[model samples]
Target chain A: MAALSPPYLLFLGDSDNPLSIKIARGLAHWRPELCIGETGGELSLGLKKMTPAQGARAGAKTFIVGLANGGGYFEPSWVGPIIAAIEAGMDIASGMHQKLSDHKEIRQAAQKHNVSLHDIRHTAAAPPLGTGVPRSGKRLLTVGTDCSVGKMYTALAIEKAMKQERLDVDFRATGQTGIFIAGGGIPVDAVIADFIAGAVEQLSPPADPGHWDVIEGQGSLFNPAFAGVSLGLLHGAQADILVMCHEAGRTQVKDMPGFPVPTLKDCIDTNLHLARLTNPAVKLGAIALNCRVLGAERADKHCAALSEQFAVPCFDPLLHGAGALAESLAGKEE
Target chain B: MAALSPPYLLFLGDSDNPLSIKIARGLAHWRPELCIGETGGELSLGLKKMTPAQGARAGAKTFIVGLANGGGYFEPSWVGPIIAAIEAGMDIASGMHQKLSDHKEIRQAAQKHNVSLHDIRHTAAAPPLGTGVPRSGKRLLTVGTDCSVGKMYTALAIEKAMKQERLDVDFRATGQTGIFIAGGGIPVDAVIADFIAGAVEQLSPPADPGHWDVIEGQGSLFNPAFAGVSLGLLHGAQADILVMCHEAGRTQVKDMPGFPVPTLKDCIDTNLHLARLTNPAVKLGAIALNCRVLGAERADKHCAALSEQFAVPCFDPLLHGAGALAESLAGKEE
Candidate 1:
């Protein structure tokens, strides 16, 4: 993480959509601000609403809207709440593919209000390709069975725990949400096909031998549509340690019905094998289970059983914290 | 290889430099156009020279200068020969780090002559990072023990042999000389560091499983300064089979002190170990020796001895040809 962003007003324009609902919930659980609220539809999360004046009073200087699947389209209907937030003197930060600055009325209002617009989806300057040169440091990448299966969440949790232990660690964000939290990172998916690994390399450059770079992983190798990007990142990251992430209740790959959810061991083996291509010493260090779907008791039992099976620490990052994984990493040889 | 350029008058400005001499000799050995002629110094190779008007008559539309270490600075003496060529109604194509098009005098003269200035150093659009997704086709990459050790030469020769055998093959050029002959390729070394591998990936995209892409490799892993680019290309190429290219009688790594030249077996093992990080199935297929230093008799004996030791067919691509290597590849199963 580089820069710390200002406190933000969470704006879930339409909470009925899956991407919007998921993001709103995730933000509340992770980075809860006193100024949290959703516009349009139902209030899906347990955060109280803040009036524009109240939000501003609470040091909320920016409005953040995290809506995936909404690529660069500013719907005509959601103008009121956004403009109201802008007029309240809050800058806007959006993770949607569409740029809010591109909206005619929104642009005019923001200009009048003198509020800055930060489109998280606006990709950074193209990154040079990874040299695949060996560097001094340990890089741990979180790989999953499918997309959005807690890879970023697990890495963030591990980073937080590592920091608590006073270990020199850094989080290398890859996707939009991770980038927003980290304050700086490339939107690897949006980059041209050739430079994916190069972009990852830029995000996580060589560091000191004692340092650990916790890289946020993207799509899974099992994902038919995005496996190339996954392989690119795997090689580009040049990771020495790997963490397998999986959603507890997933039975099949997201969007691909014919593909069964890969076993944790299989995923670990595949990842280790791929990672070894660039870093022959790469090894799977831990297993992270996203068990929000399963109750805490069930999640604990599942993790314990898997930990015993795989001979490694396994836990739900959010529920049980990342202590075991962080401890295992701290013991790793530089 | 994409677009075919008009025939050009090859210019070896001050052919004393190794790069200048190598390129001049290579062009003569391969693409021999009656229009081609060396200028600005002594003629080094055994190629017939043509007058500017005679070159034009022979369909030479441009003056091609392949100078390494020249960057973009045209020497004071070079101006005379270059301008003379331009005045003779010839466009200019240079593979120098500096842009001739940016040179005031060169630009003005080209403008006055109504000739286009092609600066090969002007990098193409930054390539996107690789997704590491699996494309359908089989790709073979030629890796080497050092720079300019016959990686490109071997790939080109193998491609030629494969095509003659009626196999579906494509030659993917990664450097300047290859790009010049191929007409359409990104000058990977000129590209920003991050996009090197991505650029290679773009040069060789996925195709049908039977389609084979012969990718030209770059720098050696043993070379400390350029290992990153080498590793990037190895992974980005997503090669299924790897061909090791080495020069005969080399005792040490080029320009790197205290580092002894690695054995062919060791080079193959190191390359396979790195390549397996991306494609687990990647295997070392053959060895191509650059035996120009050793004439025909010694070249064949050295290759035969190395072949007996490595258990892989080894040959000087220019002399004995790449028939064995191509045949071995043709027999490979997907």
Candidate 2:
């Protein structure tokens, strides 16, 4: 929950897989203005490649670990670069499961230089249990058919489109990458199971009736590994609008073979059924598809077919932007 | 998770509410042979009223803090009693959110006596992520229409009945009360949200084909505050047989004022539907009703009506001893 100082120097930590550097990619794409330079990875953000010292000299306020491996580990090789960043007088912020302060060198360096270390994954104190009490404010939640199926992107896009239309809104991040982009957020997945919904309830508390909290969703309700987190998010969200996000052609849940992705209809029905426990009037606002694998024509056709089938606006938020989806919510109660 | 040494002296901590001492009540009711004496509460377990020193002399190996309040807190008043128990040469086991070791006096006393302090609510290391892959062995899960609707009681009853019938069975606990009764369990709700299912999966690993792991379910899938925990338990359980537990005449979820308790039919349909994600062959073996509020005749009539309605055997597991429900599962695949 540390508020990270921006103008970050992203550290990619030599991860070769494109998926591993998603933290860097997401930051570069969403909050490009806050990014100063890049380090370690061959992959480019079209930003200047600079060492921690050089980036610090160039006015980068924080050094960010922009790599997200499977286990969220702090790799040994990354320690040198992190300490260098601390020596250069830049504070360190990480979304990794391992706390930066747990490392002796980094902890001592940060103490000596008086630089703050932000571990976004670790919550400071236990959040209060969810009361299921209805709170004021309009909220839109982007749910997914599976993990990494564009829930965060769709949420961000909706927030942007709503803002452009002069609607009062904010994108509430629930994951690490989203946290970095938004500068602060509750890492919902890392929270204790009993407090997952409570944490979400705390994160997106009552706001102005006209304001929208476009909450980013987590795992799918069908996913065996994380359905709990997903359901907690749904209950705590108390969303007036739920935007379903799904990949166009993916069949199985990520890394979970033999468990097929739930159909959009099934997803909509289940999410609505569970969400109604907290917010009785919750409704499906739109379908946000990750059509990255499809050609433009095919993606459009797929979206149109889904829209007709589900009787809701459907589009790839990243590809087409969320203007239509935002427009669909124009008539909802303020 | 700590494996508590038995012959316990249950400490009720002066809690007047019967519900608050459910942990002690449950332990005494289910495993009376392991309990030595009781202290500090007017409510009788029909055991001897003995001080910690007297209980220790009577061969108590552990002093159990048997109270479970709204918030799992360590009351200042209970500190002296806990320290007394530790000084009396007994290991201490607590299910409260506050660790017994957190108190300086308690820690020093335990250290001086060389007695272990077990905090059941805290896991030592993170569990692996759930893989969603089906594992061997037959598993039965007891799900509910709301929290505290006798899911644990029903599961324990089934386990006992199965054992009496010379069937291969084990009662797998997931909460603190159940954990104390079962000696050890994962305390699934205290685990990280992402690992709720994973912890369950670890707790009930693959066993012999004929062995049955009777996994105790957590919160109801219909409870707004805890449906996520329920869903995770369902998925990780991969139960071949699900016994639906409901308290008769209850109109709303526990502690949540407005959310209505899901009907038996809705509870069955939804639990089976969600549980099928990890367990496709799952079946509703029986309905276990908590008919404590009804007269014997009325309870029988209620069970009979529900049995005929759902086409599944229905009975109060505690009242009727789960024999019929055990017989209903006689033909399940081994």
Candidate 3:
């Protein structure tokens, strides 16, 4: 439960998956001090590889985090470098669907080194089913235009800004990495199909009326490959307010060819409609744009333009703090 | 794989669940010939039950089918009557979330008696994830007003009607009861959340152009309790045509109070919208009314009125056939 130490070794396994790349990029941009070096095998996908030796040279009290997103890449064969990382007296953290702790060799190595294995997807207790009763709380859910479009990052940013303003708010994580960062939360996608909503319900139980649950979203309604999870999260969140998250200038849904990218309007409308099925009074609170791909000038111009056009507060929370969003949420309900 | 030779001895095991009542009702109404007797221990719900002796005197070839829902109902202590039933040479069938074969005593009893154990929710192959690519063939998914509203029955009826008409059709089940009846199909609810859609996608793969996949639906979008699974099945089915299933005169979502019953129009519209997210051209082909509560004449009149109201074919497949709905699907496109 202790905070993961700094000088972390990020194991990309081959640096092949888009998810791995995203996580690497996110760490490089956000918490570079925690990151020492990256490791990848020969068949890595996105960028070139770096050796395990290079990855571990910085310091010894480091942690190894597997960062693959594709299927079948987390097998036993990939455990050698992970074992080496463990034997080097570094603890392990993994967001991979395949938990590193489940592998015999990895667990043995971690035990020998007396370091812990953190499996983020592992739930502490079985969550109860959703009761469908209306709970009293202000919940803000992040809905995205596509998968891996910064729903988690936006939520984290918003929570950071809210805390800075001394607000009573909590970030409810639903995915693996978010779970890891948050220390404890449901891995919503790993639950049985019927209980996804129930798990979410239990996570953000009723509290004070002013208490805000900033829920992490998954997938997207526009992403054909993962819309089910998206809809599940949307309905389950039962949000009083929603934040539309999008990567600016994306032309298509990820991995799904010929499927057109959803515009901001479309994303907002779809999210509102779906969320309203459960929470009829749900409203779009703001737009947290992921302008990571855009230039500073262009991002600011588009954010301002979108704010004017939609008549809603629009900002990249990482660039422009979520203080404006929090302020707008207080005053803007028209 | 042979058809279960059944003079069924229904084991209710202190039947305290509504799902137990449903499975009993379904068998009593649809497969009366197969059902010989019903047994419930002390804590049974609903109507009174007959003894196991009364159940088996009619015939020797009998199958003891455990009819219960929820957890921990299939414990070792509850295995006595099941063991007796197995000793009496009845092959066991269970639709409980718990598999009877997994119990030590039950497995030993079955082995000693040399009787087969049929776990309806047992999936044979590791089904592949959905490709999200355009696949060939026609698929018709049942979207429902709520859970246990006869979505599975309607799908079975439609497939029956289609097959009777000498059409190339397949009925793909998505829940325990449907899987029991169909002999083989994915148990969508039993599947892990991430793989629910993929299991469905594998169940109804691309077939001949004119071949029809009549996919049984689960849960309902309006039902907050189980909507996650419902939406997953909807997106996964990738149906070109959809049939709306509803129980007549139901005024609210089952088990979840304060949630109003969705109107036929609302159900159709919601289904079409959600289905369109995956299958853009998806159409609500017909309505399969579950008018089990109504008198024959009343059922007929309501069916006729609802058909007129929705401008779509509507019928209780048990009262009339799925013929009209099938016929309407073939002719009506507007």
Candidate 4:
């Protein structure tokens, strides 16, 4: 066999997209020649390059269709076609040459797939994030939706946990919080964008050379329509992992019989299992248990169970015992 | 000063008519040498034997008073008695005996001073607390009140912070919660008691010979009244140092400008000040900042300030960032 070609997978996650990066990094370790591809024009180029490489070797493509990190506005699942087209045999991967055939394929696939993915995000997929929207121009932004527990809390908990371990990190400085407030509560999309601005500004940030700088998207990725759009941006930006959030429990421990508190042992086996069961080999970086339903004890038990059960790390957004989820990935543990 | 005599002060919080052990331990701390005399017939004998020992020493008598931490169920203004007793050269302490008094002079003086002090208990102001029960068989089980941020998100934040630093603490073990239902949730009194039970259990676990324990109380002397019993037990336990919890902001720093993002350097001064403010001669143990209010920025700022301002060690409960709130105190790092 000739020199093995690099395996590229497209990943898209909403705001607070910690899980995506986790999966990306984890996969990087699983195989030596794997590069996570961002969803956008560059991805088109990468996919085009994959063929010649595949002509020389073999190329494989994968992407998370619909991810729900926060709200439902971001669940269009049509990103599959672009990735599939590029994978199948597209010569336009040289750059952003939108062939009429690609548009027809995206439109027809969007209709068949329910959510119109490509038609939505006409704006730059990696929109000068981290930099505030151009001081004067009012441009349409792709923001994540907010439900009960969303991006801010997740970001805060993840960062705080890292700081606990004596790692150096700055959320606004490098990790922008682009919270989209159109849907009421502080929007994580807008917050992330804002953080991106700060990151680009540098502000003499103490970033590590080893860790991958993670940009997370918050809100629902599973909504039938927005999933494709969500995947598009994630793939384009070259995100490393995704942090999925789901509602859980109620008041305290709903049941105790034989359920001696959820522990880290069950985290990955349960959460990661659920995510993958929905779509296997999608490259789930890590698992995050949103256990607001269960009391602290039960949540702890769940996280413990996940950690023990699966090789992948499992975390509870509420308990937040695992410090610095993103910081570790970003590598700048100052 | 023949051998310096017996440097002890027997403290009777309220009355001795009906003895309560909580009050007894309290009195013991105030007057270490006073042979705790029973108000029953045994008192005559007990006091007689104690008198010889007392005579051997100087004129140190049992300091009788009550309601040092907080007021009685009816009138909670007992701080006045404590302030007065301490001012009158009677070492003030925790614990309150029954209110019923036989001495008119004592009653009138106490009433005039609005002091809830008494030397007699309802039953027998004797050694055995149950010696003078009112036939209900229920000895006035002197329950100390506890009322820190009872049942609130803030409390949860405090708990979260403590655990992050690996503190051997159980935030919800007290059966306390901030969630509310019908009649304005569980009574604050019950919440306080439950919380105290958990705190005590965690703080004074099976004492190991190798570990020195650090027990956390409600607030401070200046901000007392978390519960009636803590002071007495603390006194009986001979708590040599007190770690006060003070909010970290403003007062600690002069003309501190707001930062684009919070930092650790801003808030450490306050944490240090509170810890070092322990009685001049008595050693000041570590201080734990309830960093729930202060986010990453504020918490970081305060922690730095605390380290620089006072050589005194400080902790952020939210950060659990320092050592731990519970385990560190219990000396159970291992």
Candidate 5:
């Protein structure tokens, strides 16, 4: 028998959530033969984890995981912790209350090997430079839940961070396409404008390898924007990475994968990780957040939990500062 | 008679365009005397100029003016030059090309004062920031024909320019009350959110004088949001001024004093100027054009004519740049 690729996904939600199913299916499609896991443990015992899983379906293990992204602790709340421990360096997003606060059994299991234990309930410190394109330098892109949420917030944070890093970065970057959540239907002007811009970009040659990163959000695979148009923007900008940022705890996903859209953020942590993942040629990067909006104390508690959970540093932009976060990310080079 | 306050506004629209009439009725229900535009140039001018005589009867426009706006340039043979003549500060905004440009006498008449020229034909040049905000230090709040025609563009331009000037401005300043351009109906959540947020701000002591601005765009007055909560948002964000942005030409605002909410590019200048004259204190600001999206070169000529005609700046934000235009507005202080 041929060797298999290790799993990198743990999908949540029920059948009613077509989006969750779509996500799982998307990963599987990219690399069939990937193992689907309803249950998981130290899959990499006494061995190093696989580096990249390209078409490896070869031996990847995907978890259907547990339900209750909204469930509490002491009540079989081992999903987040278990995934965290096994993933080790992997980033795991969690939902609901009481993360595995040192449960004897879970801790014992994690301690035996080099696995890590964490709980990813709170949202990302803020979004990271999701538009994965690394060669262009760190950039930001996001789709808002409304005109609010954290799109502008995170974008502004990154701008500040870039300034601190003293990088010759210009945050004047635009998706050329924007939308406002309303019943009147998608703003056709925005759609047309964005599409034309994207098409023009793809038809042009890349100025440099991974010249830019294009982060996008909102709409679903069914929506022309999420699928049809977004690609154009990413192509136009030569985005190196793709990031998606959203609140979790019980957030919903709505899409059919491979609509041709690139990387997306469903939770905060993954959103940050996405920044670094783009162009693996450079630093994958770290995360930034807001303590005031999220409540300083609460954010601190969550940041600690998430750091352990994802094995990546988590921060709040409003408190430690975007510049501070940037410094931390520099040290996270893979 | 008591001196009238400048808090009144007049909205004009047909089944196809109703913003004008809505603002009028809204004011009539409150302090009717301060509402409507009666005495000024439009009503006082000849046949082409018109206004809400009905609103006048209610004693709203004790200090009124006539300024009609619409979208005639969008029809068959209209072009940009003509649009320019109007938005350049064309007087009244209505009628077909046969009246303004085609008809020599009417074209000459359109050249008269008190009108603006230009249409929402092409984009502006310099962004509309310092110029758009009336006061360089003030923030922004706006509404457009719809969500698509450069609303956010204008806002962002203004924000960008302001930052360049070193103003420490905040946005959604109140985090609640925001300007809304009611269309068919408002969503309940939007209204509630605005209302709750507005209330919270109001309850709090006067803020420490923020340098930020709050702007909102409404979908509709009939929206569930309007009925329950958003109504308050509309009320809270409504400053002393209420200017309508329209695309107008002789063909658009037909039959004089026609329905407001002009759809062409040429009429914007005339519309804004008239709105201003109706209440000098809250006199209208200016107009931005979208020539490429609306008409042709003739409209541009007309828009330029209107600008010469009214002596008020009539421009296209995309082409002219929102900042350059907004910068000029610095001189218009009371």
Candidate 6:
């Protein structure tokens, strides 16, 4: 999946932990016009921090890394700023699980600067296994109650409020900071537990029952370490809409101390009972939360008491933008 | 994990599918004194068939590949009989997914007969992730309702009926024909979906409190392509006894056509509710089943009607030898 090369430039190696630079705060907050800023950390994302030869003479074209610890290693003082961003011509992506071409000075300076190194959690072939087979589309997903609870910022704020309600959505990405903010996905936890639900059924395939997709979710079927990549991304997301996402007052389970953090009505009733074994009319539809530890009037009274105790549309999709969870999936039941 | 050099020999490569030679009928039915027979298929685990130079002149010492099929490739007509069992001196194991050192003539005939190839579904390091904490001892696992049902032959017949009731058992293995009949394991679907429950919590760690371990189990939380490696091997098998297994008339979900095959009381109440997220005293201690398509009085009246409908002890741990499921886990409650 090497097509990466963007304006990028992030590289926050010494992780001053804003949850280890969440892939440079998810590409400076959702591909801020292909972000050409930020260098090491203090956690800024307020853009302009340059210096990989001043963001390769301000044109950038990829140099990402953007730290995401807990074993997606690749540190050694970020290999001299990634061979000085491959000697300043750029190209060297990384959503790490180590392999900037397994670092021999970033693979001979990206083969003597002809650049290209992507490794966005590596997946090229080997996927086909999952066949609960039903796919037609109109997905949604999100799920979570642990492991960085925001499920990729409530699935990119419900794919930007289902693309401002005109629908036919997309935001699929499944980690490595939503595959470097949707440049591409399927890192389903660096796949290969027999192809995490066949790489989320080849990252949300069969679309167009009025298309939707959305997806992005992982870890936490009461996470005892990535509930089997969240039950193979809920049986390869045969999701007919789920959402859930939680984090408000999380009580344990992030670094998995003793476990806890389940109840968002037992993680939306065990993710709609294992996503009804590959969507038997799955539901849940909303609840996002991540009230960044509350207090916007207690995160709007804990999202209106969990939208009246799980009836549905709860909020805080990064401070309420999933437009009431895209108007409860445009009033579901499709 | 290596260590394989057994009397082995198995091979059965032109797969005449007895479920693709379930790892040479699980090492000729549970390590028939470290098996020293059988060659290419004609389905006979009745032993003595020899010819990898007459099973290395009857001293064998590893030639395994006992076939599994479904993408564990390595076939080009079994690479000339795995380079004629590495030029007959042996050392070659393989629970496929390719890699018999990616066959350059079986890695130059095991580097010109210095032997050793053992890719029992490769796993060397990088495991640590699952920290749902709780590790003490007494684990039991063996889940399933699909994916080669008889979770590793009911966890090797409950570790050979808890070592013929002297207890303090061990077994463990996670796949690749239970790591070629338990010489080693952790191939948890060739790990890395964020380390399938930390490689089954480092293949059953923290032993001694009346030690049990058992473990072996993969794929099937009602199998939508391996319910996330059966929910990360039920939260890294913090199992305080689970058994479950099932097969008896198999309904569906093996080659995944329209799904089905779930109910044995919904796969033991969803594997004791996702194995109580790192086992909050998990239970359902029996019910192995695999009645190999019945008729021993209909598999003992279908294991006495599922042992009086799930009040546990169900049977057929290879036609009744898990000594009443190890006396229902030695009358449980621990």
Q: By descending TM-score, how would the candidates be arranged?
A: 2, 3, 1, 6, 5, 4
Highest lDDT scorer: 2
lDDT by residue for model 3 (A132-205), tens: 77889889998888887889989988887777766788998888667655645788877777777888888888
lDDT of each: 0.74, 0.90, 0.74, 0.32, 0.32, 0.81
Rank list by DockQ: 2, 3, 6, 1, 5, 4
B88-180 in candidate 5: lDDT tens per residue?
A: 332322212223344454356456634332111111121111011122223234444432344434444444554555554433322111111
Write the residue-wise lDDT of candidate 6 on A187-248 in tens digits. Answer: 88887888888888888899778888888887778878888888888888888878888777
Interface RMSD of each: 8.1, 0.7, 1.6, 25.4, 19.0, 7.2
DockQ, candidate 1, comes to 0.07
Each candidate's fnat:
0.00, 0.82, 0.58, 0.00, 0.00, 0.88
Q: Pick the candidate with the highest TM-score.
A: 2
Q: Model 2, which residues run further than 4 Å from truth?
A: A14-20, A39-43, A51-57, A69-81, A87-89, A331-334, B14-20, B39-43, B51-54, B69-89, B108-113, B331-334
> lDDT tens string, model 2, A1-334?
8678989999878867888888889999999999999989677778889999999999999999878877777888889999999999999988887888988888999999999999888887888798889999899999999998989999999998888777889899999889999988899998889888888899899989888999999999989999999999999999999999999889988999898888888989999998998999999999999999999999999999999998888999877999987776765533
| TM-scores of all candidate predictions against the true structure | 0.70, 0.93, 0.82, 0.21, 0.25, 0.41
| lDDT per residue as tens, model 4, A1-334 | 0111234443433334454233233333323244434442222312233322243234343232212233323234434435354444322111111322345655464355433232111122322222111121111111122223333345445545555665543332111111110000111122221122222223222345432322334322222111122222222222224454434542211221211222322322332322221123333344566777788888878777756655455677556744535444435334
- Candidate 5 regions exceeding 4 Å error are A1-5, A9-22, A40-334, B1-334
Per-residue lDDT, model 2, residue B254, is 84
How big is the positional error of residue A96 in model 1, measured in Å on the Cα after superposition?
Answer: 6.7
Lowest lDDT sum, 10 consecutive residues, model 1 chain A, at A33-42
TM-score of 5: 0.25
**Highest-scoring model, DockQ:** 2
**Between prediction 3 and prediction 6, which has the larger lDDT?**
6
